[model samples]
Target: MNEPEEGAAPDEAATRDASAPGGLSRRGLLGLAIGGSVAGLAVGAGAGLAGGVALGRARAAEDAHSAYGFFGEHQAGITTPVQDHLHFASFDMMPRTDREDLISLLQDWSYAASRMAQGLEVSATGAVGGSAEAPPDDTGEALGLPASGLTLTFGFGPGLFENEEGDRYGIAAQRPAGLERLPAFLGDDLDPQASHGDLCIQACADDPQVAVHAIRNLSRIAFGRARLRWSQLGFGKTSRTTTTQATPRNLFGFKDGTANILADDAAALRDHVWVSTQDEPAWLAGGSYLVARKIAMLIETWDRVRLSEQDAIIGRDKGEGAPLSGGDEFTAPDFQGTAIDENSHMSLAHPEHNDGIRILRRGYNYVDGNNDLGRLDAGLFFLSYQRDPAQFVSLQRRLSTDRMNEYIRHVGSGIWAVPAGVKPGSYIGADLFA
Candidate 1:
């Protein structure tokens, strides 16, 4: 990905009616009232933009610090430096929506996404530029905010091609052979509502609101064509994708993804992460498969366990995150030694034991308030990209007997065929549609 261009602040609203035409649903109109305060800022800009030159400098500094280009050989989020916050959403096409609706939705989303990545408004006549009598083209929330290193990655779920309705998009045969829903795994307390969708967009940014803004505006654009199925807000990324990053910790209080694939590791990426041209299905040649698993942690239960037991279960020391075999965090584990448990998470997930197979992990920690039991409803929103879905499947199957399973439950799961990146004039997924 090339360096990102400096852009302006953000804005957008939600849609109410699933069948609302042109995305001007009742909810969207209600947003115009809710955003009245922000709208005032747009009106006052001509007289005196707040902080004026200072704000412009700040935006410029933000661009230098974090922004990433949206167009690339691969989508930005996968190998781009992991951001601090995430807003991941899944959507389903509205009933009776035709191929044209899907196409237009992608076109609109692409245009808006390209603008938002540069920190620009959703359109040239954005938030306050439209006619006074009409609802604004862009929502007014991110008026002065910088791009915040935001990256938008999109994917197509199996249902997008063919669901119970049968080839609704006339592209069922185009679906990759490996794009089917993930097979059921042990310890899965799956929630039907959160598991799968026709489409998904992963928005990652240094600013939480910026990420949320991207999803909100995109959803509004989909008002009549598609509707959100479920979304997740996450912070404190659990993994790193570049060498400059330090290993981050998970909700489990252990350093996670210590040996994750680095962005510069071309050989590993080719062998494991990105789909190749020689692979089946030409449209997804430069793309890869994505698998998401919402793993809920038993916080109270794990917190009460002895420190020694925790260390044994994870096969690493909590303080320095070193392998129990007596080496630093990055040292290759001596699986031959008796120090680490055979069923430990580290041992089970290590590439050495899995025929050198690896997946690029970009997980995040999430907390969704508290449950009725007064316990925290939180865990890891695990995300991984691989050359083929089977790479993840093989690794996950080996984890069936993982020691960590006792303290976590897989509540949601999904698999998507992420397409190759878009060119300047084309929309995402254009190759498959063609």
Candidate 2:
């Protein structure tokens, strides 16, 4: 987030209500300076703004960002009033790299994210739309974009700080709050309610470090998204050894995101995605659809278990997402008989693709450190996309106690009800209950 012209301390109430760019309430901004003293948050802000941080500004040059609105506004229903132009738009990006064919890769990334944005509905930020008109085509299949330099995924995280309201961090605060620490009970949420997720989708990558760079670039766009949270790493769930797919590769060694965004079929695109429209504000529309998650894995403890037992927990081969008995990674499980072979990855036991939770999984992998020991400290920032959170929340909840529950945890979570879009001349929060 950019700095506020004025200064003040952090305020949760203001951020929750006026967190949007040009959306942060002026009244709250003024109160920040005064309240900072009362609440014990004082770094001598710019005089009147609470949302911006003075310290962060003074820090070394970080990635610059520009948050707009969710572009596919006309296609869906918005959840707030529009003080500015409205549409399903938050942030989009060009690739970031010094690699060969980087420009082409960047364009491809933009195209992919933009195409996906077409089907998305207006969400947080200063958007304009409020319907389900956003599009649903994958970058790999739809735009034929390669992961070499393109960011197949784009994302942010749940509020990592105490004062954060959605994606708006206290850019004005001299001292930012919260660390990038994964919560303990952050997994087990299978299907999310209207506003809860914990997923981070990723496949395998030849150069995990390169993937980190790509994610950072994509994160710059997400960081600009005034409505979404940002994270340093995301968990992946690919059965393969490479990382180019949006389908998440879980730490358990599973193939995720198989049924994510719509296939490259023409008919499916129109039915599932959307584009920005005049009905939305000028800035919205042409924005990407969003999927947020709060997934966690039992890495340390899971590692301690025997491989054979692990297979029983997930009901499949960890390396290929195939049944322990042998089959393709993408094959549907029978999930009928007890068929609990000593090593079979049972559908009744694990819900990787079972439990009927159809989400467009797109998340990331993360590592906290070696935990000062030999074990690798890692997990996922699980996220998923859906037309409606209500339709999926039940699906995920069913997996809360899935057989795999023993392999993961559910530490932190909350859902932000994303709206469709809005055109100019509207105000946000108009639909607090709409």
Candidate 3:
């Protein structure tokens, strides 16, 4: 029944089972199977290729239904396994709002985020349950969808504490000293509209729609208390936080984050990623600093270059992602060997050369359509969590002479002081307000 007619158009045959007279379309059949309305019926049989494709899709659907808890010792998205999609938004508090408004906004956001993380609606009176005469609490796009492993992580920017208008929140003194604007880099061509905010929320999930929905609902909840400043949508995560996952390639076609800090490495997280009581203003004790960089890759130019030069710039073989000097992808790089370029990306960013400094990376590749020049306005959305802003600044400075710098430009940048995880009864950032 799944096979096509003896002689139908190649496209139509693959898309529909035309041999079955007056039967349901191929899409209709698959929809019923995925929705579990037709459990007995086989979805993709007879055709080997089609069966494999259907099986792969079924696995993805199952993965999307998974959920993550919102309230924890630390935010889930930081060390949580990296999700495939990202909807990261920056926001600024309203000018006339006071301390109470900021506090209330965090409370409202926390409530909704906690519920949504469990695959529930923003409110009990969600999309359909709300009064017909009034607006629905939820937007309804994710009504039938699972939580998709959604995780919401919030942060406070430098402006959140004390902007040009002065300390409106009355907690300016609690701001971490390291939570300031990122300094200028060697090849910066930043866009003011896409950079900086008073507050930021990072929504990540396996499904793109779920990630977008999380951000959309949060923005609606903000209403008059805060307004969206800038946002970036990213797909195809460039890094993984777990050992089970394979190393994902970046837009540059190199296996990125091969030596990234894993979630299970508590020592590394303490030394490099998480904040400590000994370090600073005390309110942000269990928190971490987040650095977001919109690194625009010049793909057109990079693609035209020869493979060997490309490998040289990245400091790894294109095929196995192994160091040019030696062994496999996971092997420790031999910096002493002359085979690897001294200015290559690996050498400069490696902890060996940078006083054993490391940052937990959670980056993703993004494509924002195309620019007016008929060029792709796409690149890697580089995100890193560190113990201090200085850690990232130091590493980025060391990469000033990176050979890969010629093929990329840093366009958007921001840094935020991410507070510790939210306690069950208390709201996010309640420590600072206390």
RMSD over all Cα atoms, model 1: 6.5
Candidate 1 vs candidate 3: the lDDT winner is: 1
Which portions of model 2 show Cα errors greater than 4 Å? 1-230, 235-248, 259-262, 265-291, 324-326, 340-357, 372-375, 414-434
TM-score per candidate: 0.89, 0.43, 0.85
> Could you give candidate 2's per-residue lDDT for residues 1-434 as a string of tens digits?
12211232222222321222332122221222221221222212221113332121221122111111222233211111111111111122212312222222222233223212221111121011111232111111212111221113322223321223332222122111111222223253443331332212121223344344333323322221222222334333322112343344666666554544443333423333322243232222222234444445667787788877776777666677676545676666655544344224245324444444344443555555665667665666544444434334545544555666666655334433222332222222122112
Best by lDDT: 1
Collision count of model 1:
4
Which tens-of-lDDT digit does each residue in 145-190 have in candidate 3?
6667788999999999998899999988888877889999999999
Query: In model 1, which runs have C-alpha deviations exceeding 4 angstroms?
Result: 4-58, 61-65
lDDT digits (tens) for residues 191-297 of candidate 1:
99998999999999999999999998888778767899999999999999988999999998999999999999999999999889999899999999999999999
Q: Against the true structure, candidate 1 has what lDDT?
A: 0.81
Model 2: lDDT equals: 0.33
Ten-residue region with minimum lDDT total, candidate 1: 11-20
Show where candidate 3 strays beyond 4 Å. Answer: 1-65
Instruction: Give the least accurate 10-residue stretch of model 3, judged by summed lDDT.
Output: 48-57
